[model samples]
Target: MATFNVRPDIDAAVAKLSSTVGTKREIQHLPEVLWEGETVEMLATGVYGKGNGLLVMTNQRLVFYFHGVMSQKVEDFPYRSVSSVQWSGGMLMGTLTVFASGNKAEIKQVPKDQGKALADLLRQRISEATSAPTQAAPAAAPAGDIASRLATLDQLRAAGAITDEEYRDRRTKILDSL
Candidate 1:
């Protein structure tokens, strides 16, 4: 396995690669965006290595974005301070070596097959994290026409006339019929 130290001239390589592929390449230098009083900056930009995959970096992390039919955060992994790297089955896998305060840690890439599983797991975690406890909402009085029905549903949900589940199911059925 060969690990190429990324040089400052990475932009030149990106240009040449884009030219060879006959596609326009866009390199976005992430600007510092203030979110909730925290300054966020993208440490790495554009695609690199053999495949032109998306690369993202933050202040202390580097992430390689890979494709997965299922959305998963594990689909992306850190690539900085990598001690070993290998390409396998059309995917890049490696062990990242990180050092802080003279201490080291190893992080391995999630296997391709496991990537899907990892994605599913992450999806579940996120779903659980974001899910609020269901509360009963008031039922909406029947309104005339689809527009009125939707408005009634919205009003009912807002006014605690129906539960969230009821609102969602009724909305889906109404939309489907239309």
Candidate 2:
């Protein structure tokens, strides 16, 4: 997986999307709608309601944006607001459904190969956002302890205790607090 910066990096976002499976037509509108500091993690082409759009999973939110000849629609669901996400793929297409605040948003016709990955990433983001910190700041563990802590984290990944994405996120947090 590509590393998405926590800070807004339009060039990186564009480059990442270009390599992913999706339509580039809507990429032009991203700069205008993306929130400051948001990072795009995944993108898929799908249909939301009656409009064809791009479903974007970002560091902070899930967004669906469509620009047509007559109208434009942009819908964003913050990670914290997302209660659950599910993905189902058929032979040629997939569906992604997001449940948030008693509302449900479903995007259909997602690229089959991209659906599960996007859903899993969204679930990971939601879990990270909703889970309360269970311990005191590792930043307080002494400057000399940082290296050892990172090593332990890496070992946990190697041992299959945490996913690669989780390791990267935790590592980034540890480094950023430095």
Candidate-wise lDDT, in order: 0.38, 0.76
Would you estimate the TM-scores of all the predictions?
0.26, 0.64
Write down the lDDT that model 1 would get: 0.38
lDDT per residue as tens, model 1, 4-99? 223334343333331222112213222211123222223222233333333333333334443323431212322222222232222644333333
lDDT of 1 at 39: 24
- Tell me the tens digit of each residue's lDDT in model 2 across 1-178: 3433333554455454434333454666676788877777777779998888888888788999987768889998888667789898999888999987557899998877777778988999999987967777754567778888898988877754455666788999888777
Off by over 4 Å in 2: 1-22, 134-178
Q: Give the 10-residue window scoring lowest on summed lDDT in candidate 2.
A: 1-10
- Backbone clashes in each candidate structure, one number apiece? 10, 0
lDDT for model 2: 0.76
Candidate 2 matches the true fold with a TM-score of 0.64
In model 2, pairs of residues that clash are none
Best TM-score among the predictions, by candidate number = 2
